[model samples]
Target: MANTTVPEVFATETPEATVEIDAGAGKHVEPMLWGLAPYQWVSISMLVLLLFAFFGAKVHKTIAGGLDGKIAAIKQQLDEAKQLRAEAEALRKEYADKIAGAEKDAEAMLENAQHEADAILEKAEADSKAMVERRKRMAEDKIAAAEREAVEDVRNRAALAATSASRKLIGEKHDAEADKALADKVIAGI
Candidate 1:
């Protein structure tokens, strides 16, 4: 009964009497309902329902907590992945910039080498021209010296031949008295 307690019903019972319910006791006895009285059935059903509710709430709380923790972990991992991706992109950009700078430097160095080669070639050409001019002047000077020596030799030979012919003519044509007079005159002029 709603208003009765289990202890009161057992306290009023006779030890030698069979258990019986009065019509006014508000206790319904189902005939052999799985060997359980109606009150027992109600009590068992309520107890089962209560147990189910208590365990179900605990299980739900546990499942929800686990799901929340997993979600937090997943979010953290996603954030870390994003950060790593950003760093990788920055590193890639930095390397690209360095490569671009190196390429530019290489181009500049190549141009400088070409200019230096051109300058060296020009200097060599100028030096060769100067050497050629110096050689030409030396050859001309040698030729002039040989010409002067030849002219002096020819003049000396001509003067010697003229002296010899004059001596032979004077010896053949002049007498001893004329030769003596001429010698005296040549000595006076000398």
Candidate 2:
């Protein structure tokens, strides 16, 4: 029979001492404190800091008050914007009504102008007709007067010719015998 001895795999002299084992790779160990891992300790530290800030500094109250002030200011601005929008809408409606009224006034003016133009045209036509009629009457009167004057002149000339012819006949044919015979005839008739 051969004699052999076995080596202790795990041995520690203190509770705080870290254990090491040889694997095929290099040593890899995570540090610890109070039975917690490093990551756990960091998380606990962050939580304590938050608690201290909330209780000792009243940080939550200050944050809440600041947020409330900001919200109130935003609400006031919103209300002012709403009031301005309402005023703008009212102004737009007023202008629209004015434009409608202006359109109506323009239409009325056009109608009146058209009526006046028509009336003027009618008056002008009547005046022209009256003027033509008056001119025609005057021309007719002038023609009638000219005709009467010509007739009177012809009659006067005819009377003069007849008197001259009668005088010539009396001078040529009338002698002492004609004179005596006319006197005897006239005395017998009387």
Candidate 3:
């Protein structure tokens, strides 16, 4: 026999039914199925469906597990956020209580200062009143002393004037005629 080319041998080995064209309007591809009997085609389709069902169940299980993990993580994060919020609220309450205490202390201090100021004002008023009264007593005593001194001076001057007038009257009043008349009366009476 004559030596055959590679293309001729290949075309003769695979029959036209086993190598059908799968040409389309916009695609060019070789046939995927050989020229098989009806029973052989049915058997191959059933085997491919069984394989798809097995692998589909495995893919479903994997996707469900991943979704469950994501949900658990979200729940844990929400719990942590709640805890943080609780801590913040506690801190706010603590600070508010401290501020209230400080305000109370400040109010007490202000009240104490007001009482002290009132006491100081009252003391000062009492001291000033006492000083005024003492000054008044001193002025009255000085006036009384001056009046006594003036009365004593007036009495001494009056006594000196009366003694001078009596001495002058006695010197001017005795004489000779009064002596003769007084001798006659004196002889008769003896």
Question: Highest lDDT, which number?
Answer: 2
lDDT of 3 by residue, 1-190 (tens): 9887676334423454443445765543233345565567889899998988899888888888988999999999999999999999999999999999999999999999999999998998998898888888788778877777777767766766766666556446636676578888899899
lDDT of each: 0.84, 0.86, 0.77
Give each model a TM-score.
Answer: 0.50, 0.47, 0.43
Candidate 3 matches the true fold with a TM-score of 0.43
Per residue, candidate 1 scores C-alpha lDDT tens digits across 56-103 of: 899999999999999999999999999999999999999999999999
Q: Which ten residues in a row have the lowest lDDT in candidate 2?
A: 10-19
Task: Assess the local accuracy of residue 19 in candidate 2 as a C-alpha lDDT between 0 and 100.
Answer: 44
RMSD of 3: 14.0
List the lowest-lDDT window of 10 residues for candidate 3.
8-17
In candidate 3, which residue pairs get closer than 3 Å at backbone N, Cα or C atoms, i.e. clash? none
Q: Model 2: residues >4 Å from true position, as ranges?
A: 1-66, 148-190
Could you tell which candidate, 1 or 3, scores higher by lDDT?
1
User: Which has the better TM-score: candidate 1, or candidate 2?
Assistant: 1
